[model samples]
Target chain A: MLLSIKNLHASINGKEILKGIDLEVNYGEVHAIMGPNGTGKSTLAAVIAGRDLFEVTEGEVKYKDKDLLKVPVEERAREGIFLGFQYPVEIPGVSITNFLRTALNELRKYRGLDPMSAVEFLKLMEEKKKLVEIQSNLTNRSVNEGFSGGEKKKNEIFQMAMLDPVLAILDETDSGLDIDALRIVAKGVNHLRRKDNAFLIITHYQRLLEYIIPDYVHVLFEGKIVKSGGKELAIELEEKGYDWLKNT
Target chain B: MKEIKTDTKEIISKERMIGLFEKNREGLFMTDSEFMSRIRKDAMERFRELGFPTTKLEEWKNTDLKASLEKGYGYYLHPVIDVDVQKVFHCNIPHLDTAIIAQLNGWYVSKDVPLMELGNGMILGSLAEAFKEYPRIIEKYYGKYADFTSSGLTALNTAFAQDGIFIYVPDNVSSQKTIQMVNVIHHPESIFLQSRNLIILGKNSRISLVHCDDSYNQQASFANIVTEVFIGENASLDHYKLQNMNNDSTLISSVYFNLEQAANLESHFISFNGGLLRNNTRILFNGKGGTANVRGLYLMDRKQHIDNHVFVDHANPECTSSELFKGILDENASGVFNGHVLVRRNAQKTNAYQGNKNILLTDTARVNSKPFLEIYADDVKCSHGSATGQLDSEAMFYLRQRGISEENARMLLMYAFANEVISKISIEPLRLRIEDMVKKRLRGELSVCEHCVLHCNTPERPLEFDIDVTKI
Candidate 1:
């Protein structure tokens, strides 16, 4: 198993958000988590990403063989964990290239490997930019600064490509993306998927899932997984809506 | 005379002493020497008559100097035998065509400046040398622009100034490079040092002046400096002053800029260190079509106190002025910013904008900002604003959610805030140096990751971030 969560409970500002979330993902498997607003989907992703704003009241998150909670957020990323934010921050004066270089070096440090040379890093960046279909102009600008909605989302996917992780958490990455961008991003992700990697895709619609084609579908209702099934479950959930999970 | 009880005795005495000036018999008459002796004596008499200003005085209320006076700082005359002037004086930019003046302990040392090549009726030399060579010009502009009524510090500087730089750019003669004046303070003993600078930019001529002060191996040294700038009609001047003194030093500098018709002025003041610093910049738009852009940046830590007071007077019509000052305060540091824009009745169509912003890194740090606009004119566009806050919480959370540590996230946000002001700096080399200094300061305060240092230290290098959502 790539990731195992047992009875995860979390809260924000003393109010419980994630009551009890139990899930599992295997290598090479893409699990799509679909839910309506305020169903604690984002909160679960945030907690798993180790955001300090939300406190995990009770639960255990096991990644591989170690307890992921023991590591810091940056360390988690260095340890092969990635989270594509729904709204990426704009760090002015810090160019996109500079931010990624720092992140990549940090990951390399955790793995006890030497950092990529400037020549090699640029070569790798060029190759990955083609995968995500991001323009060269955006890479030279400040991180997420002055970027359009689609460009920002595409930039998130671009970053994931730079820092390849064992477990990738796409938190509402499909939001605000056009059909062309969606297809390009989906293709980029599909190309990067391997037998050693796994994905936990979080979205509000099944349109993204139809393109990415997850192996399993899970319904998150009020923070806990209410139901789980194979790929056909996503089509059923799209047709029936979230009312069935709400009543359950 | 009634004495006000205060926590600091030094402050109270400075305030009460200004009143002593009024009792002197010589109101505006000369009393001390030949060159500026009379003017200095008259100014001293005025200063003594007025004593030190109190909080009741509108301008001096925010900045109290009573403590500085009460400390009884001795005058730093000539340098001691143990001092190495060369080690104490260093110029970061040396290739400029303009002359360079180096002063040590309130005295003019040997100058290797290339003033003779500036043959277009330009006179760049030591103030004392100018007094002997061109006494007429020295007497004409010296002590003419300093205001004794409003500024006791200016009066004190004029009265006690020993040696300084004197620059005169003749009409229609544009300087090829920037002139530099380096002030080196090496007095270890508690001493008062007064330095004066006079810059006269001729009509239709352009020049750049850069002044930097270095306090090396100095303890308890007090520097009181006054720089008077006179820009003639249609002339342009770019002035830069950088103050990076020792933490134990105290500095009180007043810069007076007088602009003529169609003249343009760009001035930048950067203060990075000082125990207690008070800077007063007063610009007089005396000519029509005159424009001034004033910018400042200050970083304070420990118990340092930095006060910046700016006054732009639109005395003539159709003049424009813009002022922006940003400060970062950490530890128990305190900052005071007061920007006043005054547009007279006849100065119509005067465009003025003033902004002051500060960031407090610690709860103990305090910032007092007051931006004011007094427009007596009918047709003028004037606006002033002041804001004090900390790092944006939303921005901080956003960085953390992306797996950056809280410390690195804060540093990034602060760099952004400081970059807003630094980005406006036009000089490329100086801007890069300032950026590096800012990064070092941030690293000293925060636990920056090694990877971050590797990425940020690679000057001018760019990085790339690719996001492929399908994989993750």
Candidate 2:
């Protein structure tokens, strides 16, 4: 198993968010987590990313035989766990190139490898930009600063392509993207996928899965996995809508 | 205590004028005896009358000068050690063709500037020389920009103003490189150094001037610097003041900029060091069609106390001014920022914006920001705001969640906050130097961050890649 979370429970501000959640994903597998608003899909991504706001009361999250709970968010990132934020933060005066370089260097340090040279880094960025169709101007500008909804999503995917994480967690990556941007983003993700890589795609809409094509689909309700099945379940959920799953 | 009082009395009695001659009696260019005597007597009267502004004064309330004055500082004259003038020249940017002036202590040391080579009508020399060469310009513009009645310190500076660079650009002449003025204070003891500078940009003339102060010693020293800039009609002036003195030094600098009709003026005041520093910047849009952009960033740590007071007076119609000042205080440091924008009557259609933001890194560190806008004109758009808070906890958590260490994340955020001002600097080399200095200061190192391995990583990607990255 690439990622295994057993009976996970988390809370924030004295209120429970993730209640006894169990999930597993193998290498090369793509898991789509579909849930209604306030069902703790974002909380799960935040917890997995090691965001400090959510306190993990009871959980066991193992990534490649190592306990993921003990790792910090950046460390989790450096260890090849990527979390595409639902709402990317705008960091003014910090260029996209500088931010990506810093993140890449940290990952290199974690892997005991030297950082790529500026020449190599630029070449890699250029290649990745083409893959995600991100404008060169956006990379030169401040991180997520003045970027439109679709552009920010594209930038996130570009960052994922640059970092090349082993387990990619897309948290509502499809939220602000149009159909064209969605196709482009899904294409970028599909290009980045390999036998050694796994993806846990979280979304509120089943439209995103139509392009990314997850292997398994899980319906998350009230902070727990209420149902798990094959990819056909996503179609069923999309047809029936989230109300059916909430009642089920 | 008795000895201390006696020493303080002795220091005050001499004043800036008496101290200048006493310190530089053997200098070669001390021939203007009558001028010296008059300036000395006038300075003495002003110094005694003003008697160092106290906290009781409304302007000096946020910055108390009691501790700085109690130490009793003497004017720095002559280099204590041999300084390579060539090395200093080489350190400056080469593309700038403007005249360069170097001052050691309160006396002019290097007057062999290439001012004549500067095409068109431009004068860059010592204030004493300017007084002798161009008396009419000095009489009309000097002391007219800054109000001495409200500030005793201003009066004292004008009275004791001995050696300072005076740059005058004639109409329509644009300077190629910024005029670089290096003020090196090597005072190893508790000494008070006061210097005055005057810059006048003629109508339609464009110029840039950089004032940098670097100290060699760590002993207690106090620097009182007054810079007055006059921008004429349709002229443009870019002024940069870089203050990175020793930790034991106290710098109280006041810069007054007077803008005329259709003038464009941008001033950057960067305060990155000093023990107890207070900077007051006053800008007056005296003529219609004037625009001013003033920005400042200060980094304070340890017990350093930095206070900034900026006042923008929209005195004429159709004038605009924007001010943004940010500070990052860590350890037990304290920072104060008071920004005031005043739109006078008859100054209709005036546009002014003032903002002050501060970030405190530690629990004991404190920052007080007050931004005020008083407008008498009805048809004007004016806004002022002040925000004082710690680093964003959510941002910190977000970065930390991404596997970056907490310390690195904080550094990144702090760097971003300070870069907002640094990135606005138009001068490339100076901007890079300031960025390096900020990074070093953040990492608790006095040296440049680029050379430190702990703060900066060694280039793994060859020199070519490094150059490309630098270009980007």
Considering every candidate listed, which one attains the maximal lDDT?
A: 2
Writing each residue's lDDT as its tens digit, candidate 1 over B1-472 gives 2221112223224443343333332432223247576776777776666655566778767666656555655433333323333333333342334355666665565535423325577887677667666778777787777686667667767665646888898889988766767776654356567788888888899987777775655366677889898999999998877776767677888889999999999888777777788888999998899999999888888888899999999999999999999888999999999899999999999999999989899999999999999989999998888889988776676565455677877877777777877787665555665677666666653111111111223333221212121111
> lDDT tens string, model 2, B1-472?
0111012222433354445545544442255455555554565566667767888887777777776666665443322323334433334333334445666565454424423325577777677677777778877777777676677777667655666667788888998866777676654356676788888888899987877765645667777888888999999988887777767777878889899999998888787777888888998888998999989988889888999898988889999899999999989999888888898999999999999999988999998788888889899998888888888887776565455678888889999999989899887766766687788778777531121111123322211111111111
At residue B197, candidate 1 shows an lDDT of 83
Q: DockQ for the candidate 2 complex?
A: 0.48
For candidate 1, write residues A1-248 as lDDT tens digits: 87899999999899999999999888999999988889998888888787888888898999886898767777777677788888888877777787777667766766788988989889989989999989987888998988898998899889889888888899999988889999987987898889999888999999998789899999898888999998898888889998977677
Supply the TM-score for candidate 1: 0.87
* Runs with alpha carbons beyond 4 Å of true place in candidate 1: B1-35, B54-56, B76-98, B111-117, B397-407, B445-472
Which window of 10 residues has the lowest lDDT sum in candidate 1 chain A?
A102-111
